[model samples]
Target chain A: MISIHNLTKQFGRLRALDGIEAEFSAGQSIALIGPNGSGKTTLLKCLLGMARPDNGTLQFEGSDLTRSDTYRARIGYMPQIGRYPDNMRIGQLFDMMRDLRGYPENVDEELLDEFGLKAMFDKPLRALSGGTRQKVSAALAFLFRPAVLILDEPTAGLDPLAAEVLKAKILRERNTDRVIIVTSHILSDLDEISTHVLYLMDGKLQFFKDIETLKTETGESRLGLAIANVMRRHANENQASA
Target chain B: MLAKYSSTAAATLPFTGEPDGVTCAEKKARPVAAMLKIAKYVLYDILRNRIVLGYAAFLFVAALTFFNLEGDGSKSLMSLLNIVLIVAPLVSVIFSTIHFYNSYEFIELLVAQPVSRRTILGAEYAGVGGALVAAFLFGIGLPVAVFAPDARGFTLLVVGVLLTLVFVSLAFLAAVLTRDKARGIGLALLLWFCFSILYDGLVLVLLFAFSDYPLEKPTLVLTFLNPVDLSRILMLLQLDVSALMGYTGAVFNEFLGSTLGVALAYGCLALWVLLPMIWAERVFRKKDL
Candidate 1:
């Protein structure tokens, strides 16, 4: 479980994450939805301690996130664009990660088998296609059987079947005491796996609610339409206030 | 609870042979062990790079050509010294800057893991610096040992190795100071230029402008400021070329030519290697990857 308080990150004049606050508890698959440049990635980066927050505190399991990196042992992150050493083989990359994590025998490898990545284990990372690279990232994220999985645009470049495979894996993994935070533009994909929705607009938290409550309030069964309905209401409210 | 879920899923989907004993608590090695692990991978990557291999081959051939053409050990050493002073630092700077930029995404990936920033940057410094040092030793050191094998030849090899590390550190500093690849590389080149060429030009102007005064100490301090100059002076003193350098040369020969002076010069070069890397590490720790 993680808690963020008054998280603010400023990039020059643009406020990427403006005094945002949220809490994510275990067994909650959070769908972090936001438009482009809406501080979605920045928020995730702050949580991962990849980007230092201009002002705020992040706590994981009652411990300060920025104080030590041992907390990351529980986190498995799949970057939006996974960049790897060009000449390293897929197998070598996985081997190196396993070695670094010191968990050679405890890896999941479910996504690896499902995606059939083992067949191309010898191929250099630079030779992999975009979808294949996505598969690699997904597999690595799930490899450690981590308590928290932060995936950024995980299904963006996947094929339909691969996307379905990843979704099914997410669903299966969600049953455990794990917190899966996924950021993707595809609402239907999230609808299948996510239990909670955390929406952001202009670096501010628009809402953080359960999917059922969001559905009932918007009177829309599908998440895409429900979020669209909420956006429309917000836009009208803003215009009237102005 | 995790085992129960995995077992339930296992009934439908075949499980990989891994046991159902996955725990949230991870076992990690000590910081140095982790640093070495990352450094090993980085070293392997650099050793396999075509550009780096080509650089090694180029140095070997250049050393061989110089030795064969000169036919005299000291003359060949002087030629190789120029290569060490100019070409070695340039290659180290450019290659290291490019390598850092190319591995930007890889660094991001590593940062997301359980590793500390110190481990990542330290591994980079060790790996790149190690590979370049090995290349210099292999390409130039081997030939000099075979053809000359004198104290001056030995000093040349030491200077070459230290210069490589010094420039690599400078390159990392440049890379960390900027987000843009072009800018990083430009800054690296500018640093190389300042140390190798501009610094010498400024020293010459100072010597001419201060010809009326006893400028030996200031010029000696200026030489220590530039690793390239420190290396050249270190090697030239060993080559016994102070007679060609005039009165200041006699001063340098008297000062840098002694045991304490040599130790001080090497210490200055070592500082050149450490200071930039330490500064770069500080910048990289809080850097937004």
Candidate 2:
């Protein structure tokens, strides 16, 4: 579980995350959707301690994550664009991550096997295509069976079959009550896995609602159309005064 | 089998279902292990780089050529000093800067790991600093040790190592300051240029402008300011070339002629390495990946 309070981050004159307050609980499969430059990645980075917020606090299970590294052990994060050491082989990279985590007692390798990363052990990360790299990222995220999973665009670069496998894994984890936060642009990709939706626009939390609640309220069954209708209303309201 | 056991345990134990991170906290990854692991990877990556290999080869050839060209070993040591002064810092600074910028993705991935930010940064500094030092020692120091085994040769080696550390630390600082890779590299080169070239030119002007006054203290201060100048003075003293050093060298000789002065010179060199290191660590702690 993670709790954020009044979180704010700014890059030069541009504010990336503004006064964000949110919570993530176990068993909640959250789909974090936002337009470009709306601070989705930045928010995820702040949570992972890659980006430090200017104001407010983020805690894992009531203790400040910024204060300790041990708290991070429970989190498995997948960056939208996974960047690894170019020269390192995929096998060595996995070995190093496992070594860094101190050889956890149990590591879930479903995605790793399903994605067939084991066969590409000799391939250097530089030689791997973008989709292959995404497969690697997805595998690592699920490797630990982490209490919290922060996945940024987890399926963006995966093949259709690989994407389906990942979706199935997400659904299985949701039933097991593991916390998985995903940020994705593809509505259909999210519709099956995510139970809740948190939409962000211009660094603000436009709304947070259950997927079914959102669909029912918007009078649209499709997640993408429901979200579009909501955005359309927001745009119309803002444009009316302008 | 292990997965099945874990699944069964999770199902049977209500405590495992609790959201508290402390209950089933991972075996903490020791900071030392984290640091060493990262350093190991960084060293492996750098050693294989064509640039680092080229750098080491260049040093070997330069040292070999100079040693053979000058019939007398001491004469060659003098030439080696100048070369080491110019080449070591240039190569170390630029190489470290580029390595830091190029490893951006690696750094990002590491940042999200369970390891602490301190471990991440400490490991990075150790990694880069260690790799470049290795390059310098093998490429440059080995030849010097073989050719000139005296204290003077050893002094040159120490100076070379110190310069490498100083420049690498400065590169870390430069990399941390700006987000753009090109700008960061530019800033690093500019820093190298200022210390190696511009700093010397300005010091010369200051010495000339105040030629009439007793500039001993000021010149001494000035020499102490730039690491390159300090290194030059140390090298000159060791090579027994006080006559070519002119007035400032004499001033340095008077001050650094004693054991205390020698200690102070090394202390300053160590400080040069330390100041940038501390600055870089501070920047790294707060740096956005």
Candidate 3:
């Protein structure tokens, strides 16, 4: 479980995360949905302690994640744009990560074999297409079965079948007690997978609730429409509060 | 309750196999392992890289040709080691510094993982240093080794490794201090210049200005700060040719007279490896990814 209290991240004069407070419980798959510059990435980075909040405390279970090894050990992060050393072969890259984590033999190598990655193991990562790179990232993310997984743009650049395979893995993983936090511009992807939604707007937490409730309240079944309606309503509510 | 407590403890702690009872004692080792991995990759990459390979081959051939043609083998070998001590560090500083800046995205990705910042810096520094050392050993050290395989040869190789680390540390510091690629590289080059070239120039100016005074002790004292000079002195001392360097040798011999003094000089050389490295580690820990 992760708890964020009074988190405020600023970049020079620009406010990135505006004193947002929220808690994400275990076994929950949460979608961090927002437009560009909505601070979705910033929030996730703060949680990972990759970005320092101007003022806030981020806790994993109970310990401060900002400066502790315990929190870092329990999580796996997949960046939106994963860049690898160009000359390294895919198998070599995996081996390097395995060495870094020191859990090579214990990790599940079945998915890698199943996805035909075993065949392309000797291929240079630079020569691989975007979809292949995405597969590699996905494989790295799921390899450790980490307690918590933070995936940024998880489905980006994937083929339809590959995307489905990843989505299925995510769903299956969630059936267990693992927590997943995902951010993406693809509404339908989150709609199909995310149990809860955290909608961010202009560096503010607009809402955090069950996806079903959001759809029901907005009178829209599709996630994109539901999110749009909620934003409109949130604006009107803010005006009334003002 | 005992069962529950045990289960929670088991869940929270993986048996580290290390005596520390920290599941991550091995995890801490991962940084060194990761660095080795990077070094291995750098070794392969640089070896296979047409440009680097070409440059290395060209230098090897040039050194061989020069040695074959040169009349004075000792003088030539000494000069070559001197050039390597000076230019090898410069190359290591520049190449490794540029590599760090160039691999920002790669580094950020590594930082996002469950890795300590010190591990990341160490791994990167080690990786770059390993590659440069290998290149130097093969490209230059091999020639020196062939020419002087005695204590002088062995010491030259040791000096090569030390010089590699000295420059690698400077590059690391430069990379940490400035985010701009050009400026970071410029700073590293400036550092190389100050240590390798300018500092000696300034020392020369001072010695000239106070020609009448006994400046030998102070001059010897000052050489400890510049790793290049320290390595050069160490090499010269080992070769027993301190007599040839004139006042510089007299100053070195007068102050660093004893075996303990020589050991202390090498100790300072080793500290050159530690000081910047410790500072770089601190900078990296607080650095924003």
Leading candidate by TM-score: 1
User: Native-contact fraction for each model?
Assistant: 0.49, 0.49, 0.27
Candidate 3, residue B234: the lDDT equals 81
Q: What TM-score describes the B chain of model 3?
A: 0.84
What order do candidates take by lDDT, descending? 1, 2, 3
Quote the chain B TM-score of every prediction.
0.89, 0.88, 0.84
- What residue pairs are clashing in model 2? none
CA lDDT, candidate 2, residue B130: 87
Kindly report the docking quality category of candidate 1.
acceptable
Task: Tell me the TM-score of each prediction against the true structure.
Answer: 0.92, 0.91, 0.85
Write down the lDDT that model 2 would get: 0.82
Per-residue lDDT of model 2, residues A83-147, tens digit only: 89999999999998887766666788888788889999999999999999999998998787778
Worst 10 residues of 1 chain A by lDDT: A63-72
DockQ (Cα-based) per candidate? 0.40, 0.45, 0.32
- Candidate 1 per-residue C-alpha lDDT over B1-289 given as tens digits, one digit per residue, 9 for 90 to 100: 2221121111112223222344433222355677788999898888786777788899999999998999756788899999999999999999999999988877988888777787888888888988888888989988888998888888999899999999999999999999999999999999999988898899889889988998988988888888998898888888887689998899999998789999999999999999999999889988988
Q: After superposing candidate 1 on the true structure, give the runs of residues whose Cα lies further than 4 Å from its correct spot.
A: B1-29
Stretches of model 3 off by over 4 angstroms after superposition: A69-73, A103-115, A237-242, B1-42, B50-73, B208-214, B238-248
Q: Which is the better candidate, 2 or 3, if ranked by lDDT?
A: 2
What shift in Å separates residue A168 of candidate 3 from its native position after superposition?
A: 3.0
Lowest-scoring 10 consecutive residues by lDDT in candidate 1 chain B? B4-13
